[model samples]
Target: MKTMVQIVDYAERGQSLYIQLAVTDGETEKRISGEVRFLGELLYGELVHDKKSPLSEQARMDTIAYLKAHFGR
Candidate 1:
């Protein structure tokens, strides 16, 4: 990674996991919405979807399986 301006802060308490994340080259900030579950135990991943997502449940499962096959699990 090249030199870039950065900003980071955090807070933890209560019964929920609330996090804010972002990455940038100082001019543009590309941020994605994320939800953390069972904090302190694991950090799971998710694919974004609107109220309507074309991919079926099985399609999603197969795609994840393929990723695990090529990448480390």
Candidate 2:
């Protein structure tokens, strides 16, 4: 399946950055909300998926790659 990811919202709250994403794979569309927490020079993202829509692993990986490229990280 061809996956597509769109960033719906991005915001910085304190030491963490929050991102809202829309992920689609032609057949299904899901919402993924993530928080990127900064720890010194390192950062990690925790993603929450929409149970109703359900997300594929490929779609999730694509979303993460999109976010990395979007931030130029």
Candidate 3:
């Protein structure tokens, strides 16, 4: 599976950011939105589907890795 992330909104000058996470595997794709807090080197957040279902562990980890790689400082 391949994952991509897009920033939808930001608050507090980078203290927090809202993002859309998209994952694609072959012909299937899934998307979710979540808020992430960036405090120094710590990054954490919760991702939920449109129907409020919890994301799979792999999806969550992939999203976090993408965010950290692109957005972390």
Against the true structure, whose lDDT is highest? 2
Listed per model in order, the count of residue pairs whose N, CA or C atoms clash below 3 Å is 0, 0, 0
In candidate 2, the residue pairs with backbone N, CA or C atoms under 3 Å apart (3 or more residues apart, or in different chains) clash, namely none
Ranked candidates, highest lDDT first: 2, 3, 1
Give a tens-digit lDDT track for model 1, residues 1-73. 2212122433456543333322222222333333322244333345213223233444334433433342223
Stretches of candidate 1 exceeding 4 Å from the true structure? 1-54
TM-score of each: 0.29, 0.56, 0.56
lDDT of each residue in 1-73, candidate 2, tens digit only: 4777777777776655666666665446544444444333344554423333355666656665667667655
Error of 2 at 36 (Å): 6.8
Taking the tens digit of each residue's C-alpha lDDT, what string does model 3 give over 4-69? 556676564555554444443222355655566666666655563323435565556665677678
Q: What TM-score does candidate 1 get on C-alpha atoms?
A: 0.29
Is candidate 2 or 3 superior in lDDT?
Answer: 2
- Candidate 2 stretches with Cα past 4 Å from truth are 26-53
lDDT minimum window of 10 residues, candidate 2 = 46-55
lDDT per model, in order?
0.33, 0.57, 0.56
Clashes of 3: 0
